[model samples]
Target: MRWQKSDVDKYVSAKEYIDTLIIPLIDFQMDQDLENNAFQNEVLTILSNELEKELTGRIMLAPSYYYIKTFDKDQEIVRLNHWVENVKKQPFKHIFLLSFDPAWKKSEQALDASFVWIPKIQSGDIGSKEMQHTIREQVKQIGELIRSYW
Candidate 1:
């Protein structure tokens, strides 16, 4: 399920079956690397959407948690934990934080949820067949990983 009214209605009716939540950590900062950041955001969004479809009944894809790229890790971690704590009130048994940012890998241990960092695709035509294939494979692997935690 996704963060949409229709999905939320379904989720409310079947909340017990949907025990997992996937929150995409999106980075936004205007700088020289703007294009790369945008690309990563697009890819991550696609990955999150596809993953939601692949594991529809078991997981809910929360709205992306956007953060400035240059934010301090300590402060960000505290903020993110607070967000997770609130989300936990919904009875989510497993919360996954998905991102393409390498920085999160360094602070994974400090996070309140599972931190999944997928390597960023430097540049690409996201609409191309090659990209679609890659994304499908990624979703498959990620789905397996999520199921492993079950």
Candidate 2:
């Protein structure tokens, strides 16, 4: 299920069978390299969408949470947990926070949600065959990691 009208309607009814929530944490790097940051943002969104599509039966992909680059991770924890609280009413048992930002790795223990951090890819042509292949492989591994929790 996804954060859409019809899918969410179904989720409202069949909530028991779908117990996982996948949250994509998007970081907007306010640096000179806007192109690279844009590429990462696009791929991360695509990755999260692909994961949701592949595991549609059991996972709900929430809207990506976009935040500025300067916010402190510790402060973000409170905000992140608050978001988790609202969604928890849906009774999702396993909440996973997926990000390319390395900062999340350090704050995983403090978060109520499980954090999966992937290394940031260097700036590249997002549409190139090589990049697409790399994304496919990475998402496959990420799917397996998510499955391990189930």
Candidate 3:
């Protein structure tokens, strides 16, 4: 649910997100140079295409989530409800989260939709074809479940 700032700072506001410490490594990539966003956009496009093909359209993406240093339950509820309403107005059937951390489970109410937890490869090493196939099958199984429920 959270985006590495380096992944979205150009498209979104920094105040509304979680800052990953590792983004420092990509800090240079966030420059105001035109090529920066272009490069980022290309990666996003490829990733989006890969995800779309893998999930077969069962997945729904949300704006990134930020941790509140001083949490406000009411404000959080309002924001989440708004997001839910916005998505419901879209062409989506179900919403899911590809989260490496379980804490993101709290956002389940944000979209008022079903969810799936996709595993992460923190090593940045996605392993072999077998591993990729396993992840694909998991996503496909989730897609089938979403279709069955919706």
Candidate 4:
């Protein structure tokens, strides 16, 4: 289930069964290399969306939390926890933060949600067959990982 109007309507009565929340943490720098960063952003977003699809109706995908590449990690944690607190009102028992940013790996222990940091992919054509195959494999692995927490 996504955080969309129709999905939320279904969730209103079935919230108890939808126990997990997936929040994507996106990091990007908009400098002269905007195109590269844009590719990275799209790839990461697709990856997160695929994860959401793998377990639809069991998870809610929150809006992606985009942060400037240079933001202070501690300050961001405080802000992220604020979002988590609000979601907890829906009574989600398991929360996971998905990111390709390496910084989150270091502070994973301090976070309220389980943090899964995937290594960043080198920029490439996501439409290519090879890229699609790789993405599918990675998404399968991530789905298994998320299910492990249940």
Give me the candidate number with maximum TM-score.
1
Candidate 2 vs candidate 3, lDDT winner: 2
Worst 10 residues of 4 by lDDT: 116-125
- Of candidate 3, the 10-residue stretch with the lowest lDDT total is 19-28
lDDT over C-alpha atoms for residue 61 of model 4: 90
Candidate 2 displacement at residue 64 in angstroms: 0.6
For 45-103, candidate 1 gives per-residue lDDT tens digits of 99999999999999999999999988898899999999899889999999999998889
Q: Tens digits of per-residue lDDT for model 2 on 31-144?
A: 997988898899999888888888899999999998887888888889999999998887999999999988888877888999999888787787899988888888899899
Q: How high a TM-score does candidate 3 get?
A: 0.45
lDDT of 3: 0.41
Cα lDDT of model 4 by residue, 1-150, tens digit = 877899889888897789999998988788888887888889888988888888887998999998988879999999999999999888999999988888888888778999988777787788998888888888999889989999
RMSD of each: 0.8, 1.2, 12.3, 1.1
TM-score of each: 0.97, 0.94, 0.45, 0.95
Model 4 spans with C-alpha error above 4 angstroms: none
State, as a TM-score between 0 and 1, how close model 1 is to the true structure: 0.97
Which residue pairs collide, candidate 3? none
What TM-score does structure 2 among the candidates reach?
0.94
The predicted structure with the larger TM-score, 2 or 4, is: 4
Report lDDT per candidate: 0.93, 0.89, 0.41, 0.87
Q: Order of all candidates by TM-score, from best down to worst?
A: 1, 4, 2, 3
Residue 90, candidate 1: Cα error in Å is 1.0
